[model samples]
Target: MKIMTCPFNGPRPVSEFFYWGEIRPMPDPATCSDESWADYIFNRNGAPGVKQEWWCHIASNTWFIAERNTEKDLVLRTYLFEEEL
Candidate 1:
């Protein structure tokens, strides 16, 4: 079975977690055009590569960020949002 390490709860079953999506920077609303905001909301990177994503531990109601590789399906690290970006 797959396992994911939760920052608060330690390692747990992967099934206990929920994957949100990749972390992307939002375009500056003040300076960005309509097309830029549209692209930011609609487009997603589907390519296989390392990316930081949002994850939640359902049982504990804990939300965190996970750095994972899509190609290899490996989690490099996990941390809370308040932690270093």
Candidate 2:
């Protein structure tokens, strides 16, 4: 079986992690434009490179950031939500 290494934990089954979505253009809903809101919600560009992404640790009940190598199925880095500035 394929396993993934969660930086918060150790190696584990891929099922333990849930892909929340891409992390970008997180705008303030109150002042955001219709076009910007639509783009943020409906558009997605699955580019392969270093990017910030949201992921839920289903097995651990934690929200965190993940630096994913999209083309390699590799998680370059992961940090808890609390770690954010």
Candidate 3:
């Protein structure tokens, strides 16, 4: 079974966690056009590569960021939203 190390909860089975989605920057809603806002909400870069994504630990209700390599299906590291590793 795959193991994911939660930033706060340590190592645990991957099954205990949920993948949210890739972290992307949101355009400033005040200055951005409608088309830009729509595109930001609906589109994602689906290319296979290293990406930082949001993940949640179900039991503990912990939220964190996971940097993973999609091509190899590997998680490089996990950290809280305010941290990097």
* Top-scoring candidate (TM-score): 3
Candidate 1: tens digits of C-alpha lDDT, residues 39-67? 99999999999999999999999999999
Q: How accurate locally, in lDDT, is each candidate?
A: 0.96, 0.78, 0.95
Q: Residue 9 lDDT in model 2?
A: 77
Best by lDDT: 1
Candidate 2 worst ten-residue window by lDDT: 1-10
- Candidate 3 regions exceeding 4 Å error are none
**Candidate 2 lDDT:** 0.78
* Model 3 lDDT tens row, 1-85: 9999999999999999999999999999999999999999999989999999999999999999999999998999999987754
Which ten contiguous residues of candidate 1 have the minimum total lDDT?
A: 76-85
Model 2, range 1-85, lDDT digits (tens) per residue? 6566665777678788788877886789899999999988888886677777888768886678888778886778788767877
RMSD of 2: 1.9
Task: Choose 1 or 2, whichever is better by TM-score.
Answer: 1
* Candidate 2 Cα errors over 4 Å, as ranges: none
